[model samples]
Target: MAFTVSANFAISADGKISSDPQRPSGWTSSQDHKRLLELRRNADAIIVGRGTLCADNMSLTVPDQTPQPLRCVVSRKGNFNGNEKIFHSHGGDIHLLVTNAISCDFERDSVTLHFANLTDFIETLHRDHGVKHIHCEGGGMLLRALLDYDLLDTLHLTWAAHTLFGGTNAPTISGLDDGIFFSSRHFSLVEMIESGAEGELFLTYQRNDAAK
Candidate 1:
């Protein structure tokens, strides 16, 4: 409740964010990249699942913006290689949120580590760190957790017609183990930008909580 959480992703017409064996989403257009950067520039913090960091080596950069947004990575086990680019590439602080279920020590001067569940983590981000807006660039599992917790307020999706990544192992935004956990959540279209002649659609949806 302390922060407005937004999730963003690009998917193929078949509803796959990745191809076989969890391939990196390198096929997305430059336009999508620009939009991602724009979101980063406007937010107070950026979040990514640990799987996304492992798969894409993301830096979460906010170039040309003063007081760069904090980069946060969430992991259940607090597991990470110290040499990843996310550690060395950003100009702002990097934090790790490892659940109290994890007993592993993840403390260092280079990064601040917090032990909290997702709910407590959001409160801490708002109260202690003064973060009001958070944008999540996902790897699916994290998106499901936010949705199930009723923490997500908005979603940005891009539908690409030319690409078809059809694989059983591929993931969409919410790959919940228990299907329909978010059946009560409702979202309405807020905006749509159709790319000219490419059959590409950039869509924004906001959860309709105020309506009901």
Candidate 2:
């Protein structure tokens, strides 16, 4: 049996997942941030792509008042600063999963680095790290891989009202083949509603076992 995975992210009403490279505000509403932080508090671990880590310089830590979830990054190239905020001593537990060929010496108060096969990474996370629920805060390619591998069991999407960069480089929730499976067979909508924050809509979907 494959371990279960969940993905959560914000998008625009126009289906744009990200804004222009020069600006990223308004892509996620304040209420969306609150809800996402709540999900982070409930999750066992939070997974993100290297690009997110590098681009945002994110510490992956919740506010001081909230309980923090373990941070995990997926990177094949192992291209990240060891002393970044996410890997800092004050940050909560952190883990990095990289390809076997990449090498790095990361030493922090509670940092662990694992080099493993991409196919088995999720299994290892569940078996060895006690990660029962994973919240993937993605960067497109990583989400695509998880969807392609059928590793994601649930999706929580918050659609913001504003539009962003509509060019070829922006990330969207539904990929080329994604809509076909999601619409006809592999997945089913579990919930959808216009949340109270601004004009955001919260959508949730789950996989259909019969289609697997």
Candidate 3:
């Protein structure tokens, strides 16, 4: 069976994910953080880019939650120090999807899977691991790959209008650099809520198969 994919991001008014490529998104409100955990509750696994993993120092573990979801990270080269917070946290089994040919040595129980590309890894997750729903908390580049493959089924966005990360190099949901997908993908808004007090808008979109 094919698994469903969803992603969540906190975008700024200027459509930037962060002011700097290495900066963590600490500007978002507590409400936004709460929503992130809420989304994790529905996921069978959480996938993130290595840059996001490191930048946020993410544990990838849902707090006080049972049957913790698998934490997966993707990187071109598996060059991670064993010091990432995910390694020390008590979460579900960790899986590393290395998309390039490289050898990594880390003394940890994490399982490393080598794949030629992101699409292969995503397919293998459903085929081998019984992953029915995968959620992504991204740092842009990984989200771009999902959009490139047209595999993302749902998108949840926290539009924080009070902040602006206004740099040409700042990334949107796609990435830091300028590029276009092979084809335009369309989405239909499923839900929209405005948090006037927080100056944020919560938006949920579902893939529009008929449109694109």
- TM-score per candidate: 0.92, 0.82, 0.94
Stretch of 10 with least lDDT, candidate 1: 100-109
**Which residue pairs collide in model 1, if any?**
none
Best by TM-score: 3
Question: Comparing candidate 1 with candidate 3, which one achieves the higher lDDT?
Answer: 3
Candidate 3: worst 10 consecutive residues by lDDT? 106-115
- For 147-170, candidate 2 gives per-residue lDDT tens digits of 766677888888776555476656
lDDT order, best first, reads 3, 1, 2
Model 3: lDDT of residue 81: 88
Instruction: Please list the C-alpha lDDT of all candidates, in the order they appear.
Output: 0.81, 0.70, 0.86
Clash count of each predicted structure: 0, 0, 0
How would you order the candidates by TM-score, starting with the best? 3, 1, 2
1 versus 3: better TM-score goes to: 3
Could you tell which candidate, 1 or 2, scores higher by lDDT?
1
Residue-level lDDT tens digits of model 1 in 140-188: 8888888888888989988887898886778888862448873678899
